[model samples]
Target: MAAAIKLASDRGVSAIELVFARNLFSLPVVATWLTLAPGWRAVRTRRPLAHLSRAGLGLGSMTLNFIALAMLPLADATTIGFSAPLFATILSALVLREKVGRHRWLAVAIGLAGVAVAMRPGGASLPAAGLAIALAGALGTGAVNITLRQIGRTEGVAATVFWFTVISLAVSGLGLPFFAGSHDWQLWALLVLIGVSGGCVQICNTASLRLAPVAVVVPFDYLQLLWAMLFGWVLWATVPGPATLAGGGLIVASGLYTVWRERQLHRSHLPATPTEL
Candidate 1:
């Protein structure tokens, strides 16, 4: 995903334009998914409003995170974005009314401390706008995770994934009047790569939630830091400093602990369609 973003930005695509391109080109892939899953019938929903809400939250998360990536070093941006899981823990308790024990509560506090460390108050080097925007994106992502868990109960992964891309396309289309421009065949090919990969990522994410609870699966997100660090280094010759390393470690620890506890409570099954959901 970061690689696509890097290519898009290199092709002189604005953040919103990339978001637009992602959804626009993604239409074909998602349409294929819908047809294979049985066309319009797969997307028939009892909760249009819920799907709309998810789309809004998702749009917000993607836009902000992309902007942050453009603004900050990739490693730093990814580390800060890790706060989403902590936010998910709190939202799960408050919104979903899921029980959160003292262990998770303590973990949240520690995660915030990690964020603070990564931010390094009064740090002249990092862009404050990037940090703030990334944190806000993470919060929205947390809400989106909780929302997915709620809707995933009755919604098929195909339906949930399809509606989001459709709605996002509509909302982001409004920006085309401002961002309208031309791209070469190379850029068009990159857009196709971005679109198809983005669709598969969305499918896997939605499917994971259908198979496991939020706390059980979100820990896997920490792997983004590894990807970010690798992309940053191999592409830009960048390496994260001590603060990013320490803070990222703390956030990973918190998420790993949550996954461990959740697994102890519930053994997850990974069938294509979960009978339980």
Candidate 2:
């Protein structure tokens, strides 16, 4: 998903074009599920404010992410963006006052170290602008994840996604005047493909989490890096250096450890017989 977004941006496509394309592509599947899924009527929520807030966060994260993609290699962009989960863990402890253990904090430190390695200073000649944008995107995405956790308790995933699409479309549309321009057929197809693939990825992600434990599934999310690398090399011919590879490994390890700790915490809080939806 990140690769596709960056590819479109590299081709000089606007963020609005990318966002609208994703929405249009995912519309069919979203519409079908919303219409035919059992208990679809029960998914509506009364928390309009929460929905709007989440949607705004989503828009900010995605927009910043697109900008980062345009400036950074796909693998680098994705690795930096992956820091969101670590940020979420730290923020949860600070803002929500959740109890965080030393082990988790250590994991966060290691993850940040990895990010630093990947984003070397003037010595290694890394793109500071790209790293900065990726960091901003990660922070925004972390906030969105925290907000989603709060809202998820009262709203179904479908309802959350629905509001996200609506709000993101509306907000991104307003920015059209700034970046909007003409596009060729190829650009149009790629933009639309981004939108459709993003929606499908979200659905798959939700289902994957429901079907398997986070400890089991979160590691696979790293596969996105492989995809990003492949796309970056094959399409853009951007190969990562030694520092990037090492830093990405550290990030993945720390991220996986953090996820494992989170799952342990969640299981500790829940009852023996988990409640079914």
Candidate 3:
């Protein structure tokens, strides 16, 4: 993610271009693997509308995130984006009718406070366009997560990923003629690397979810912020301000608390002993 952000910043690539590059390069590989894999079949959906909606939201999220990366400091962009999980929590309560306790709500509020700290007008003074892009990305991500939760019971993960890539590629391709421009070999290589890394991140994320529950994996995501800061400094000499650091720390802490609370809830609902085990 940090590498992709650096590439976007350096190349002045548009969000749509980065998204197109990602899906154009990665989807074919995923589709081919799915085609060859045993027991693979076309995803049958009673609710095609829901599937399409989720795919659209996913594509929008990716596009907005790319735009934010291009426009904001890597650390600030990443930190602000981390608020997506909090948005997801709130959305899940409203959309999924999931019971969210007071504690979780408090955590969400605290996390948003962190976001405010990072985005305070005089502190970092990130361009309004960048802040808007980041917020849009976070909201889009929350929508995608809610839609995924609604349809996940009926759709295979690979199918969902595949369709998202298809939608993203199609949408971006439609706009490509307007934004098309030539790039040198170096920029092309960076774009390729971004695409590859994006694909690998998705694969790794899927693998992690399969290996462990989401609560176990989510906390590790905070490490991305650290990586973003490091990459920004090393590559672009972008050092975050004190307020940004404080805000980022609060966001990470709140996120970790949310994960921990989720784990506790999961454990509480489990039977005292597993009959199979």
Winner by TM-score: 1
lDDT of 1 by residue, 38-138 (tens): 67788889999999999999999999987887788889989999898888889989988988888778778888788888887876499888899999999
Residue 166 in model 1: lDDT: 92
Candidate order by decreasing TM-score: 1, 3, 2
* Candidate 1: Cα lDDT at 90: 90
TM per candidate: 0.90, 0.86, 0.87
TM-score of 3: 0.87
lDDT of 3 by residue, 172-267 (tens): 899888776788888777777776676666655554544543334545677888888888898888899887899889988888887788788888
lDDT of each: 0.85, 0.75, 0.74
Model 1 — which ten-residue stretch has the worst lDDT?
Answer: 264-273
- Candidate 2 per-residue lDDT, tens place, 1-277, comes to 6766776787788766677667667766676667777346744789999999888878878878888888888888888877776777777677657676897788879888888888875676657887899999988977776676677667777887777776777777777788777888887777777877788776665555445433344445666777888988998888988888888899889867867777787788886774642
Query: Which regions of candidate 1 fall more than 4 Å away from where they truly are?
Result: 37-39, 267-277
Distance from true position, residue 7, model 2, in Å? 2.2
Better of 1 and 3 by lDDT: 1
* Decreasing lDDT order of the candidates: 1, 2, 3
